[model samples]
Target: MVPQNPGAAAAGRAAPVHYTHRQILEILSGLMIAMLTTMISTSVVGTALPTIVGDLGGQDQLSWVASASLLTMTASTPLWGKLSDILGRKLMFQSALVIFVLASVGAGLSQNIGQLIAARAFQGLGVGGVSALAQVILGDVVPPRERGRYSGYMGAVFGVATVAGPMLGGFIVDADGLGWRWCFYVCVPLAIISLVVMQKVLKLPKIKRDTRIDIFGAFTITGAATVVMLILTMGGKEFDWSSMWTYLLAAVAVVLVIGAVFAERAAREPILPPRLFRNPTFVLCSIASLAVGVAMFGAMIYLPQYLQIVKGMSPTRSGLMTLPMVAAMFVTSTGSGQVVTRLGRYKWFPVVGLALVASSMYLLSRLHVDSSKLVIGADIAVLGAGLGLTLQIMILAAQNAAAITDLAATTSGVSFFRNLGGAIGTAAFGAILNNRLTHHLTEGLAAAHVRPPAGGGTSLGTPDAVQHLPQPFKGIVLEAFTQSLQTVFLVGVPVALVGFVVVLFLKELPLRSSVSRVDQAPSTSPAPTDAPASTPATAPTPNTTA
Candidate 1:
């Protein structure tokens, strides 16, 4: 049916527009660099952190350096996305870059652990913006049907950074003159290059409209998340799990979350819009992302401990050992993305992916203290393949399902859940490991009638520290850790299956062919993109499977 007023309809939006493959690649280069800065920050620090804390002289504060960033990064993600809607995406992206660059400098020059931790926290605020905006920007620049092809490159970047960060961190700490400071300093130049390229190549139409900052909503949500994160990080380590402190913090987090809900309802432009929750696709994707985080990060963090402490490998070697997983992730993510783009069907990838995740977690649980490296490698590769298929595809589906007006919120909301899940999984898994290890150690020590070693051998500080324990004690400690890790992997199986169940319910809407959602109201929000900007023409249309 022809439009009653063709000229008026055409005037409502810019002419039908899309980017050439070359144009998309140009924009993606800048995004990929910024993405690397965020991705590698934590993992790179993981290896160098041992050396960093040793030189800085605050062994107790070591965990804070990592957790602080994660805490801030996860909490601040939604705020960044909302700000992009109020302000413009380009300015927000550039602003995050500046913040990150400055924080990196401070982190490198720090003479004390406190300063380093503080800088890392600030780095997280920036990292949060860069991380969320990258996905939001991707949605703005590419349509859902063709998005998979470019997302493949993003998966490759993620795969590379995941392994490279640890390897580079180990190399830096090992090199005579490089030092731990270089670990922070090294990304500075790459970030600066990214900033320059973004300035030159990335362009999105400027939007001018009256928009509120949603200050109250931001505060409540951040407070709620921060309180929960503090409980997770501090519990089972800084204090007793059953202590009054835990109870107090948990109560505070609950109250803050309740407050956040009300604040979001009242605010004109909430950080997380209430309506997004009503979208089935958004809810399902968020749930699935949370599970993905639990499986992916739980494995990433603990597997290293298993390799370094249980199997006696160097940090560099452990990083290298995980390459099989990375290779599998790269192949499946890219391959699956290409298939999704061609067929315009994505439900199968994540469904199959989560099944693999569940299967791999169970396989990992079956690992013995004496499991061969090849067997371990094979199990992780399955995990990599599953993660590759699920991670970004969930975001893509969420984006495709949202209205043009909700694009940024949908992208960031899913991301926030994924990171939140990671925080929860990492902390919960840590607790499980500590508890199970304690039980196993007690049993082993009693069986042999051995006394506890000089420095509380059960906790056994680092992987390096575990290696130095005397003969029988070393063997006992290794066995305890091995058993505890099996429980950790085993626990993840149920979690992955839950995510698989959630993804199965998601509605696969037809992939939109245009850069912007043409069937919605004129998008008032400013988005980062190179595509032509115009008001949408047609009345909002319901999603139909493509």
Candidate 2:
């Protein structure tokens, strides 16, 4: 008999249900569009940042352009997931798509860098919502034992976006009159199309709960995250790292985090339930996700920039350069998902994957301005292979470890950390690049004995515009930019390895064949076997794996 889980009963009365392959695919078709829409919205701008900043004249705030969206996405992820548990999944999913479409409009219409960042921040709210719910809805239908089959499809969608976004952005930016704003505009049509498709295709067993939304928990957490992001993205650039304002902001962040912890403890339907942290799988997966986020976004956002700025490649060429990495990601992510489904084991994927990620980052650090296209492609391919292995597996492990009632919470918790890592990583790496670039540029220019440009320092411009700089100055600029990028890539090595170490402690629990936690099989294979039997999602021993 399956052991009774009190937590499952307390959350909501879930009806046991399942869908056929056709039905599942139909639902996924719409979900994939939404996923593609958001994923494209992010990467499409990776190659466009220089042009965006050049047009708006806020090179210092360039990182904020990306960080603003990521910040809101990270902060709002859990709230979206938790709310879906209380509200209807279909209702929540559609709402997010609409929000994303409208925000895309605002982003495209923006005249200033500040306006664009604001619009992106709003867009991130929808991004956070749609991404979390997509996974939640998947859990509602696909049993943990079989989730890998569908997860491969999600990985494929992600791969496509990674490939298409940059290439499209490059083509648009390079094409006359289309401009970088079109990058934001391109996602709107896709999002609108997905909204209608999801409305008709997606269906789920609704769990209606009368519990109050954790407004306090959400507020404190959002506030804390915002402050931390401000410090990370702004500290050295906005003010000196050791300035009094930095200390004040740090203290405020600490207080807000403490408030969030207390609020969550008291909340009836906490945005992030304190109980989920008790599960070792959840905790370990969260760590791995956070580290991976740092490494993944750090690479994705910069590789294209490096090619365009330092190597003097057109935006289109830069986008094309990333194909190897994206291709590897597609193959490995799909392959790993299938392997996990067939073998019923996932722990090794992450342990090995994260190691690959760290090694890849090291390989990237080794790149110079003169590195061959073959070497560059091979290094990033390693990164793609690493990410493909771990990205979906971490979430799968977390979901399988959770009670069915906690599915939404578990999925959101992992996503929240990953986005948080991305936001901070993007900003931190940007700052690292900018800081090193400033120093190297100054020194290189001085060594060259070139007079300072009109703006006093190196006047930032689009990749094409930068090509117009005269002789030794142009040569110095490439060397300095390449050197700065080296630091950014090297810093990522330790960060990804931190994830590798944390994942080692993540014990692989048996996958569940049933969709409901309360209906799991009683028997569990306690030893290694060709196919270990499924296990019940028991209440885990707090802070202990056993």
Candidate 3:
């Protein structure tokens, strides 16, 4: 009979149970669906933001619509990971789903920007949980050797949802009688479905451990992250880079981070163990994840702007134009995962992936106002292939290198760096775009003897502003936008190269074939018939078989 106690095997009284392919797939279906709902919630809201802000009469608070979610999501990711390690994955994941669905409903029903922002911030907490726990659960269920095969599917789901979210959001926003509220409402049903499926199918051994919650460490890290995110989101836009406000915020961020480090060291159960940083593989992987985030998010934030402003594509068309990149990412991610699983080697994937990313960024840097759509698609596809190769592989490596007990924390740590990098990259790149565009616009307008409007070059970023300008002035503005975007792409090239270089130093660890810790002694007793059949937790093996 299935053991009454799920933790029995984990406690070493019985053999660790292994899931069959069918069972694994059944579990994965729920996990992926849950993951897709989170991704869609973020993406679907993106295109609707302008409409939502207009309806809510909060033009000044526009950025907070997105920033609210991002800040809380990044800050809470590590906490969720560590919590799952202390508690159980299934409960944490379900809780996240429920929170997300409730928040979505609240967001949909909001009467003002304040309410919407608060709801979105709450949604971010859930998103953080779902994102961290999903990977942690994967680490718990799948052996490192076989994880690649499934990771490919997870990556593809992420890529697809990202691409589709905007498209669906735009459609909903433009449809008569539907409006932007439906964007939030749409996620509720899907989320409920995911919750029900997960509740029924997800079953994992719960490890009951005596561990103290690192309350002080959690506060410090959350404070540090919030400070950093605020600085990134507000530095160039809300305050001048050289302003005292900027300096004060930066100083506060640094001080908080230092405080977090000290707090972590003294905690009985650190949110992020100090030992993780000491592991060379974890360090390299974290760096690589950070670099990838910088390049990927930096580029993604601006691509639609380029298409819509420079090419004059409609929002729907702009979303459609990114299909090549998404398609290439899906294909490459799935294929690479299979290759990694079969060969039992992963180091080369990121090496080659980063190389492609660098090459694509450099190529994109050369685009001009007259660049062909085919050329743009080809450049982005290359970058997509690079992303597909690197993102999951790095996380897999980190999971493999970590001790079984650290699985959740390690997974979350890797995610934390990536999110941190994305925030920094998006902010830095936005500043670059603003600065370069302004400079180009001023020079071009002066050369044409055309006086800029009251806001000078500040208004040029708006498509409507540029479209209404006199002939020569409009052309000049378009060229400035094109040049600024090219520079942004050029900046991404070096960041991608940094990731490539970091990957080269990553120490390759043998992929373990069993779900359990290598140190855990194997039990010879047959698995209880009712218990799931699990491969014994054994030491790493050389076997390459899938």
Cα RMSDs, all models? 6.0, 6.9, 6.5
**Which 10 consecutive positions of candidate 2 have the poorest summed lDDT?**
537-546
lDDT per residue for candidate 2 within 318-393, as digits (tens), equals 8888898889989988998898889888899889899999999999999998999999999989998899889999
Instruction: For candidate 1, write residues 264-338 as lDDT tens digits.
Output: 877666788888888999999999999998888788777877887788877777778778888999999899889
lDDT of 3 by residue, 217-316 (tens): 8998888877877776677678987899989988998888898899887776788888889889999999999889887766666676677677766556
Better of 1 and 2 by lDDT: 2
Quantify all predictions' global Cα lDDT against the true fold: 0.81, 0.85, 0.79
Backbone clash tally (model 3): 6
- Taking all chains together, each candidate's TM-score versus the true structure is 0.89, 0.92, 0.88
Tell me how far the alpha carbon of residue 145 in candidate 2 is from the true structure, in angstroms, after superposition.
Answer: 0.4
Residue runs of model 2 more than 4 Å from their true location after superposition: 1-12, 518-546
Per TM-score, the best of the predicted structures is 2
Clashes of each: 1, 0, 6
Residue 445 shift from truth in candidate 3, angstroms: 2.8
